[model samples]
Target: MSDTTQMETGRFALNSLKMLLVVGILTLVANSIGPETGFRAGFVESIPGMGLIVLIGLVALLLGRAIPLDLPAFAYAMIIAFALALPFSPVQGPFLGYVERVDFLATTTPILAYAGLSIGLQTGRMKEVSWKLVVVAVFVFFGTYFGSALIAQAVLSAQGLI
Candidate 1:
């Protein structure tokens, strides 16, 4: 590949990595507080914006080190604004029920989509492959979350922790 192509590829990888880091950290914070409390903490306390902070921080660090701003700042700003505003709208209130919780998840989707797209693109086989890997990833993600919740509930039941 040409130098420019290599640079573009590197930029894509770096952005994807940064997005993944933000999502992972957001997930950790949400999970640590437990579901009920996390839902409260997210909307009332700005838990979703935590991911934005991490993204901007990473960008600033990259700029300080002389890395070009490959990611579009305005696009992210619009996303953040939309994320912060959508749940508060009356239309979404009836459908989602919990404005804060729904907003938090809504905000988190961009990064998750970015990560998933990065994976699907970088594999170089998505264009030729059947739906196998996509199906597998979906199942794996669901399985891990469901399995953990089930195990936790079982342990709590056995120990009377519930």
Candidate 2:
């Protein structure tokens, strides 16, 4: 590979490593707060389950790092993980139930928190926005929000979940 290609590969691997760290920490925290028993022996018991998830995710990330891929490391990792998680896949027996928890939102909280902070960190750049631009941005945001909600509602209604 050229110097530029090497640098790009390193950057991708670094980003994937950071993602693994954040996601692993979040997954551990979510598991520690058991769906049934807040945080007692249940948390300790759930360690292996959460660890397994992070472990597989790490393996995927490493696999992506070892070979250049068109997709981002994490994206490729997720596809790899999904393949391993299919119902008929032998690997599914271990993580399927743990991942099925209704409160899986716990893991999402950290990701959302990171997103919010990332946007907030751009406050300096955002100051250059004109009022007109701001108004348009707000409208676009609302439009996307409403559009997604409407689409979700329609899908849920069709599935008798509404």
Candidate 3:
């Protein structure tokens, strides 16, 4: 392809990514409403929590980009969010109170949508793996399931709650 054509394609791809992210952000913001509180009141209340999540995720992404790490952006974003949400983190002070009423079911919509988009982009490579992909997927599923169950059982046993 010509240089001009390549540049145009790159521009188009960047614009497309920006558009998708904007839509996802908007969807997450709007869907922040809780079922228990109804739309109007919950919509107003959820904004701060949603804002904090997006800010933290954006900061994480920026930090990841600044560093010379091989990890994916989402991994860093998750780690930053998780760390901030930890009990000892002073950063989570006000946000924790709002967290309980935050509509996580609504938040999953864009997250799953992006996950689908990511998987869809790898279709050809997935087809190359074929049945082996299924085997790997099954192993991943069982590993996660049983691993979590084992941890939970251990923790519960230690606590004498099980």
Identify the leading candidate in terms of TM-score. 2
* Tens digits of per-residue lDDT for model 3, 25-73: 5655656543554332265666666666666666665555556666766
Taking all chains together, the TM-score of candidate 1 against the true structure is: 0.29
**What are the lDDT figures for the candidates, one per model?**
0.57, 0.67, 0.66
What is the Cα root-mean-square deviation between model 1 and the actual structure? Answer: 13.7
Cα-lDDT of candidate 3: 0.66
Ranked by lDDT from best down, the candidates are: 2, 3, 1
Clash pairs of candidate 3?
none
Q: Is candidate 1 or candidate 2 better by lDDT?
A: 2
Which portions of model 3 show Cα errors greater than 4 Å?
A: 1-25, 29-34, 37-41, 69-93, 98-101, 151-161
TM-score of each: 0.29, 0.61, 0.58
Candidate 1, residue 129: lDDT:
65
Give a tens-digit lDDT track for model 1, residues 1-162: 124544454576588567657664655455445555445444334444454445654544444334454655545544544554586765444323433443455445566767898897668876666699789889999999999999999999999989
Q: Rank the candidates by TM-score, best first.
A: 2, 3, 1
User: Residue 162 error for model 1, in Å?
Assistant: 2.2
Consecutive 10-residue window with the lowest summed lDDT within model 1: 94-103
Give me the runs in candidate 1 sitting further than 4 Å from their true place. Answer: 1-120, 133-138
